[model samples]
Target: MIGVSHIVVDWGTSSFRLWALDRAGAVLAERRSAQGLAASAAEGFETVLETHLAALAIPEGVPVMMCGMVGSRAGWVEAAYVDTPAGLDRLTEKAALVPSARRPVRILPGIAQRGAQGSDVMRGEETQLLPLIREGFAGLACLPGTHSKWVRVEEGKVSGFATFMTGELFHLLRSASIVAPAVDGAATVDPRSEAFARGVGDGLAAPDMLGSELFRLRAAWLLEGAGPDAALARLSGLLLGAEFAGAARFGGRGPVALIASGPAAALYRAALAQAGVATVTTHDAEDCVRAGLHAAAVSAFRLERMSA
Candidate 1:
């Protein structure tokens, strides 16, 4: 146990989740709100949080730590990236703890890195990856989110990761792209056919053709006369398949841990199976974040207390 007061915040672009934990990192109270980085833009961050904290009746001066897109350029403040292959020790910053009657609040900095090919960065996912990597296999952790991350773990530390906007791209193609217009209003999806596997196979063969692959969906409808739902599943299959292939190169026959749930996990499972790679999935989203935050908080508190 670090101390009596415990607070953890996973503030992102779309939503904000706060947890009040006991010294042992057990949740006492938790709340979720729409006051994400985007929502707070108009009123500013402090106001966004004040409203939520007031409603929760949280005391002041509680030690608080945060993760997520809230640390991005569009977020309250730029926390900077800790780079890939990083560990809990790389997390730095005692962000101006929001002042309150009970405690101080601080935001942790994300991570960033640059190499010859290019530079990559992350905001909050690092927090979630921390404990997961430490708990299971310690080498090369892949986290699938809106921006799927291929993180390299060395000695139980997050060394670095690359983020591909796979999920968002899937949404855009399905909702806005011409190739996926047929699937815009889909209600259900069926991935139990050869078409699904075919898309996966094609996508893996040419991962970079994702943008152009949308044309296949449209062509399938016009030429092959495929249905809307089938087209949607095909597109989904293509994206997942490509990502799986690209990410597999990083796995290096090493164990890979997937941290996600719902339908997304299923799709990933199918793709991995098709590719003949073994993986493990943890379904609890909040639990993953909590475990991550627990590791982060423990490390930070120790470092802070040590220097003190």
Candidate 2:
């Protein structure tokens, strides 16, 4: 309570990101590493974290707020899940405290969607949605990742949502499946390429044939010597296309608030255009994460007063 500072962390399954913020919630220093939740579990979460903290010269008593898989059953602590219709208050209220840390450390819980839709869970992404909550956004949102999420929000609270494993499938099919041959060593899927568009159209038109469509990637390569670029593009397009089709029901909710960074955003935008998404609102993923964490810091720590 006395450090008058905040260390906000987005500790994910495959990567770790931390931001050091001063009293006003402005970032003072930041770091990112491959020491993700799973990796940190082996290296010791405290050991990895304290190393970064020491490098940043963060003074003692600084409270740390974290979100993501770090709070998962396998990570640092099982922070539990906050059910759907969750809001800012619920997140702060349910934050799990880590008594073993040398400093005050709390990890925010993930959001869970249950029942007929199939049991679905999202961790770090829930924090990224906080900016929308701040703006009282009422609409659908697409958060793309290994396990992509299509979220529905009424004002600030999440109403319902769905997940798509588009990225995961793309990786698996390209790396491990029999379909790997066609796309192996292929160039990265070009967002604007004809193959990308065609694949998207094919997926959008006939999601039922995804299995067959994926197989065609190899068959085409073997038969016509179709290049890997096309193969890779078509593969990505098909997977993302299927994802779009799956989330098509929510498209009518309004323009989707797309929160993604770098290539993912570009790929989604291209696919959205092909998917007939007329209007798209994009938010910088980093900006949203920072704002969301700042909000959490305020709600959980009354951050400014402490820093003052």
Candidate 3:
């Protein structure tokens, strides 16, 4: 077996993913857990990280590169932000070193956008964009998640971007709002459902009416006998459609390249299609992050030979 040479971590607010990579950047082993920044902050970042490394039997001195909330002010070490119109190369150049670690540890800095539209920032998503930058991809790219991001890239630089609270809103509505009972115990929405498509149309046509439309879901359940599945589908469609509508206003002109995986990807594709927006490309979020981390590792550790 090839000896582990570097460790890549994508640590977020609620989840953690670790990959042990050889010099060639191929994964030798992986570890994933719910021990995110919040948990790690309480348990001690060093302790959480060392325990994971010990379980993987990774040798000491293997350099570690991390991205995401792990670099936020609330994380192990604050990595600061690189302003927008930023290039991927700048991310590598500005990586912050974590002091007092047994092994070399560096955290990649995130990108920030400040303008009349207000300020916005992202942590781990910057690493995921390295592959797009390397490929010279220009246009709109959407990263769908808890807080979805719509980024506009031009000539290998992040020109501008926006964030939507779609996923978080969905969680709140489904679990804590008046619409909760309608979707309680319901299975995930089927992306192809007609109810979902209708909801998308409703959202695009009247995004300003989202609050009223949400109440309509409950009305449909209480008055018109709507099924829980249909209500769930409608809710999902409404939220995603509103997000796409907002993105359309700021995404400039071009086809969207969606970076996502699994069910979220399918749902986004369906929503976009229903909204009449063509998706020119789709990249797996996991794959992009891995490739991005590999790229960052190469740039950060230039002196190290990257061949097994």
C-alpha lDDT (0 to 100) for residue 235 of candidate 3: 95
Off by over 4 Å in 3: 303-308
For model 3, where is the 10-residue window of minimal lDDT?
A: 299-308
Instruction: Evaluate all candidate structures by whole-model CA lDDT and list the values in order.
Output: 0.70, 0.87, 0.88
Query: Taking the tens digit of each residue's C-alpha lDDT, what string does model 2 give over 1-308?
Result: 13337999999889999998876678888989999877899999999999999998888778889998999999998899999888888988899999899988999999998887679889988899997888888788898889999998886898789989999998999999998888878877899999999999999889999999999898999999988888999999999888888898776335788899878889988898778775458887877787787788778987666766
Identify the candidate with maximal lDDT. 3
Error of 1 at 54 (Å): 2.0
TM-score of candidate 1 against the unseen true structure? 0.86
Candidate 1 weakest ten by summed lDDT: 94-103
**In model 2, which regions exceed 4 Å deviation?**
1-4
Predict model 2's lDDT versus the native. Answer: 0.87
Candidate with the larger lDDT of 1 and 2: 2
lDDT of 1 by residue, 24-54 (tens): 6788778888876766888887777766666
TM-score of each: 0.86, 0.96, 0.96
What CA root-mean-square deviation does each model show from the true structure? 3.6, 1.9, 1.6
Model 3 C-alpha lDDT per residue in residues 212-307, reported as the tens digit of each score: 999999998899888999999999899888887788787522479999988899999888877778888999999899889888887897627543
